[model samples]
Target: MTQIATIIGGGVIGGGWAARFLLAGWDVRVFDPDPEAQRKIGEVLDNARAALPGLYDMPMPAEGALSFHDRLEDAVQGASWIQESVPERLDLKHRVYRDIQAVCDPAAVIGSSTSGFKPSQLQEGATRAEQIVVCHPFNPVYLLPLIEVVGTPANAQMVDGVADTLRGIGMFPLLVRKEIDAHIADRFLEAVWREALWLVKDDIATTEEIDEAIRMGFGLRWAQMGLFETFRIAGGEAGMRHFIDQFGPCLSWPWTRLMDVPEMTDALAQKIADQSDAQSGQHSIRELERHRDANLVGMLRTLKARDWGAGAVLKGHDKTLQAAGRIADTLSDIADPARPVLTVDRAVPLDWTDYNGHMNEARYLQAFGDATDRLMQIVGCTPEYIANGGSYFTAETHIRHLDEVRAGARIRIETQVLSGAGKTMHLFHTMYEGDRALATGEHMLIHVSLETRRASVPAPQVAEPLARLAKAHDSLPRPEGAGAAIGKR
Candidate 1:
């Protein structure tokens, strides 16, 4: 329901936020002080728009309008939500907030993508103080699920409501109990960064070594579940209290100076840069970003399978998107019943895949989705129908993968409408090779109005064809499966 969003910054973080909101189907307006903000953001948005929609199992609706504003007030006007990702400086943020207060509607929520600055500090002198809060997201804003929401006492109620709204849009909002410098996640990150600096400064470990130690070890688990949840599981039946009791001694160790900020010396800076250069070699910045996004898509999808923490957020977002519908081009492929279809038989090329082997998991869903799209088109649901204010939104889906699929496999998909109704439709999809079923996806879809965001009669142009198909299959028994659930919760 977050239909219009304004992004007040065109840096990496702001661009990522724009991608996230735009992909989620919000009309996005971007404002930034930099003269080249639009160009930089456009480049980022180009990759984002190409990669984001393809991550899901359903075709996402066409991205909403993406426009840039030379003035912050112009961007904030009438926006439902405003995200400020401006430079991390107090005076600039204050100026922006003052301008936002004068322009943003009373109902709109204003969030600052600040890593550490508190709401109290960020909202100083703002007339509409309750509307402002800090929403700290990690780098690669579009991929990471966690956004720390820090609110001052005066704005806590408004911020909590905003957090819920963010959840509705597929973001995980962690509400900080109290305001603190650097907020919560950054505090932990700052600690690690401090140690990383010490290691580089003393020539004890290379940048790659430190990265490996974390990634090959705890970093993997931390990516899916946070530090505390992992520790809770690690304690087995003992729970958090017991785990804390056992490891509390580490708290006193001189291993990390959590409060210390390392001095920026040229010798240490050069060493860090040289080590990083040696670690990454000649990969371009774009390549590195693609790698990061690919890994994020894979790891997040894996965690989504477990439906714990970050994965839970991804799943929830997927559900929200299910309502948006996707469009796929029809292909002239059918399933052959006699062979074992490999998973790679039906795949779509996602723009974000890196040099790493295998398609990222999000793209796997996207591939199966491409097959689903072709199936829908074959059955007569076209973009023209959707544009006429009628479209199919996926309600639920269950996909089973029997094997691993690598990239570049010639894939085909077969679909069967499991059931249909005025408001709901069910489909069975099989990704296939020439004669085999690789993966099966059963989905339920709802017919909806684009403007209402509610169930509505399908347009005659689209409905007539679907009704014909329904009649053709009426005498045929429903597929030996459950139909999609219909009606509102």
Candidate 2:
């Protein structure tokens, strides 16, 4: 059975967790205190639903249903994974964890999305302290893969295992050895941040210039190779020790005040804001997020084409979701029930008829496949998307031999994405004669990574649309052919 995950809190982070799990085909139950959680999360999901599909080249599997709950205990019942994304208040976190302990299964792993707070502090006095772990993810958890896992010794393995599970879903889970107060990455950021504040305070450079220095210079290099490593390369052919010998003196240079703390004042904020505006002008928070997401997609896609490590991680996550079961099936079965009829206008060509005095069987299949392709394109599947090393390959197909149309029959194949997702998509096609549905075919297609020639998931770019089609056709019950199992290709 596909595991069910429960998310407590339905704000941005919680909504992202919901999207990640839902798109990957895990049933999700979300609980939030705000009365408007459902409406708000729905909007977030809608935006995600549109944006996520373009990330992949293949069809997406069916998305999991999102059930909203007003009660916390109701959401945790039978949940295999419980993610706590409540507001970052120690007492509030403790209270929520205590409540979760009452309903969640003993084996279930509990994760807190606290950026800098230690799990120990958050788990204080909680009944399930042993099961608690901090799962600090960068904003837009659905797109970014970095998830820092920190836990006490009692549930450390469980936390690591959870990290592995997250890795399976295309997340990069960094396991911290000991539960530190601010955690690892944040500590690194703090040092640079402190120095940056000094740079601004000393008027060494404007905020934009500082940002440009990082992004245009070291930041581009850092995407593929991190800090110390880049410095080693700068050290030349003599390698690390020699490089360090030559540049080690710079470490003593009073260039940055790494330990300095910035006082939060209106003047400081204004100075920062003004400098930020000077750098990139002003943009609303929403615009910034769009710009970030667009850049992320572009960079990740570029790296993905090259099969670089970071890109590979993203690709693996996408493909793993695709290779698994049910996701694909749910996505492909999207059909328009209200309008099952399709019309076609074409002249009767003599070559279409066979010796059997009917339209050739091959031609019928060909015509129907063409129609299916068009329908898929209309419903979000496109050739440019499919051809770019990701596409759907038919695994199994059954065409019901119905009443035949003669050589003069002007027909069009009506089709549906029957089901969608990484490896497999279920499609239903019908050959229509004017108003009558003459023949029907149920096809199971597996998305193959053309590079690997193995069943793989479609990249997010491709999966998102199939998900939409699935939602639209969700009310349309499963057809008879849907139950037929697809054989190995």
Give TM-scores for every candidate, taking all chains together and pairing residue i with residue i: 0.70, 0.65
| Candidates' RMSD to native | 12.4, 14.5
Q: For candidate 1, write residues 48-104 as lDDT tens digits.
A: 654554345443555678998887778888898999998889999998888888878
Give the deviation of candidate 1 from the true structure as CA RMSD.
12.4
Best by lDDT: 2
Question: For model 2, how does the per-residue alpha-carbon lDDT over 189-262 read when each residue is reduced to its tens digit?
Answer: 88888888877877887898888898888877877677788888988898888888987898899766775587
Where does model 1 exceed 4 Å of error?
236-246, 259-261, 323-489
The 10-residue segment with the lowest total lDDT in model 2 = 340-349
State which candidate has the highest TM-score.
1
- Residue 467 in model 1: lDDT: 59
